[model samples]
Target: MARTLVIDAHPDATSLCAALVDRYAAGAREAGAEVEVIVLRDLAFDVHLRRGLRADQPLEPDLVRAQGALIAADHVVVVAPVWWGSVPALLKGFLDRTLERGWAYRYRSNGLPQGLLAGRSARVIVTTDSPGWWLRGLMGDSAVRQLTRSTLRFCGLKPVRATRIGVVHGSTPERRESWLRKVSDLGRSDARRTPDAGKAMPAPREIASDAAV
Candidate 1:
């Protein structure tokens, strides 16, 4: 059976991001994939990477379990909100502390970084208050790119897909429901696919929202 890990990066347990996480996990479970969820808000780890990569920092108990989950998962889904053209500090700090050198990646003799977590796939779902066009055109989709490319892919998660649901500040309940269904479908589809280690990373897929700016 496929093992999927869903990470909810929102600081609030009651946020919309948490709802999306719930829907996704539900779908994955319904599809027969074993699903595990990591809610960053509930984890007891400090958000600060006080010691940089140069020094050895001890992992908190929660972080240690999170690492084991990542290692075991065939697919990873991250749900977060875009804050100031980037991801929240909570999510960023989780990555900083978790995907450390020698664990997620290591430098080669040629000075190139080798990813240790190859063969895993990922999906990033981001909720934003900005319109899709404004985020894609003006803001340059920085948040999604940061998570999908600079972070997940850097750690060797392949073919990472992205979904952007937004204009959320003024969105109606109907639109929100549609986004939840879409995400659930994504989870179902992802649960059926096995990660192909040789496949090249494709461009991130954008799931547009209907809410007007």
Candidate 2:
């Protein structure tokens, strides 16, 4: 059976981003896949990596469980908002604290780090007030790219897929519901099976919101 873990990084419990995560989890469960959700806001762990590669910081209980979930998951879905052109501090901190050395990666003979977590796939869902096209053309998609590349890939998760929903500042309730449906569909599709490693990484898809409404 497929095992999927959904990480919700929104601080507000009632935010639309959290709702999206719920819908995704529901769909995955419907598909008979085991689903787990990690809400960062609810966790009591410190959101800062004070030591930075020193591996001196001790992970909290919540972070320890999260790390185990990540290792056991066949697929990982990260849901977060893009703030100031990057991920929120809460999610970034969770990554820094949990993805520790000797756990996620270790240096190889060439002095380059080799990833320890392999054979899993990841999907990144990001919400933003700015349009995805603008981020791609002007801002270079910094947040999503960084997570998928420098972070996830660095830890050995391959073929990472990303979905960007944006211009949310003025979206109508109906439009927001439609976005949720799209996320549910994504969840269902992933639940059916693990990602095929042989397939090429598709270009990031965009969902334009009624932000100007």
Candidate 3:
């Protein structure tokens, strides 16, 4: 069975992201996949790297364990809202600490970085009130590319993909339902991917199924 690690960045366990986690976990479980989850808000950590790898901020116990979890999972899911067009502080800090050079990646003699976290897949789920068009056109998904390509995939996780749920301020009932189905579908599909093929995994909404949320 595939093993999956879900990093929940939302502060509230009762949030929509948590709902998706529940949905995906359920789907993967039914598909015989083993799943583990880390809720960032609940995990104690320092968001600032402080020395930026010079002195190097010490890893929080939670971060250390979270890194270990990442090392063990076949798939990694990062769920959070976009604060100021980027990831939440909790999630960013988790990455900063957990993905230390020697652990998650390494700089090669040629100046290229080798992704140590190879053989794993990754997904980024972003919740926002920004208009989808505005984000897609103006932002160019800079954050997702940074996290997925320049970061996660850079560290070896394959097929990294980003999904955005926009206009969160007040979505229509139908829209909300659509998003729910989106989550459930993603869960089902994640259940089936090659344990390590996160190479641009499609967002749950993009992988729609007939099932109701």
Candidate 4:
């Protein structure tokens, strides 16, 4: 069975992002995948990388378990909220502190990066109050690019997919439900594919649009 890890990067468990994580995990489990979740708010760990890879900083117990989960997963799903055209500080801190140099990636002899977390796929879901045009045209999809290209892909998670749900501030309850269903469907679809199968899947430039907002 495929193993999937869902990372809830929202600071508040009552946020919409958390609901999305729950729905996605439920869908994956329903599709027969073994699902694991890492709720950043619940984990006890220092978010700061004080040494900046220059010195050794021991991993906290929760972070150690998180790394183990990442190592065992075939797919990784990150659910976060966009703030100031980027992900929350908590999520950024998690990335900085968790995806370390020797574990997630290492420098090649030629000074290039060799991502060790190869053979895995990823999906990023971000919620924002901004309209699709503003987030894409003005913000240049900063949060999406950071998670999908700069981080996950840099660590060798291929075929990274992204979904944006937005204008959330005044969105109707029905619209929220629609977004939840879409995310759930995405989870089910992703769970059906094995790691190798994911390599063959053509990633959509944008899985869902907030143009309707």
The prediction achieving the highest TM-score against the true structure is: 4
Record all residue pairs in model 4 with backbone atoms less than 3 Å apart, i.e. clashing.
none
Once fitted onto the true fold, the runs of candidate 2 whose alpha carbons sit more than 4 angstroms away are 195-213
Give per-residue CA lDDT, model 2, range 1-213, as digits (tens).
778899999999998889989999998888778899999999878888887876477667677678778877888999999888899898988988888887888889899989877888889999989986788889999999989998998998877999988678999988899999999998998888774234322332232233411
Q: What is the lDDT of residue 87 in candidate 2?
A: 91
Worst 10-residue stretch by lDDT in candidate 4? 204-213
Score residue 71 of candidate 2 by CA lDDT. 72
Question: Could you give the candidate ranking by TM-score, starting with the highest?
Answer: 4, 1, 2, 3
TM-score of each: 0.90, 0.89, 0.86, 0.90
Instruction: Compose the digit string of candidate 4's lDDT tens values, residues 12-100.
Output: 98999999999999999998899999999998777888878799766776777788788878999999999998898899989998898
The local distance difference test score of each candidate is: 0.86, 0.84, 0.75, 0.87
**lDDT tens digits, residue span 1-213, model 3:** 678888888888777777767776776676777889888888766777777887655565676677667767888888787778787777777788778977778999999889988888878887888887877789887667768888899898887877888788887878776887787678668778745443433222122132421
For model 3, the local distance difference test gives 0.75
- Give lDDT: candidate 4, residue 67: 84
What is the alpha-carbon lDDT for the whole of candidate 4?
0.87
**Any idea what lDDT model 1 has?**
0.86
Candidate 4 scores a C-alpha RMSD against the true structure in Å of: 9.9
**What's model 1's lDDT at 185?**
92
Which regions in candidate 3 have their CA more than 4 angstroms from the true location? 196-213
- Model 3, TM vs. native: 0.86
Compared with the true structure, model 1 gives a TM-score of 0.90
lDDT computed for candidate 2: 0.84
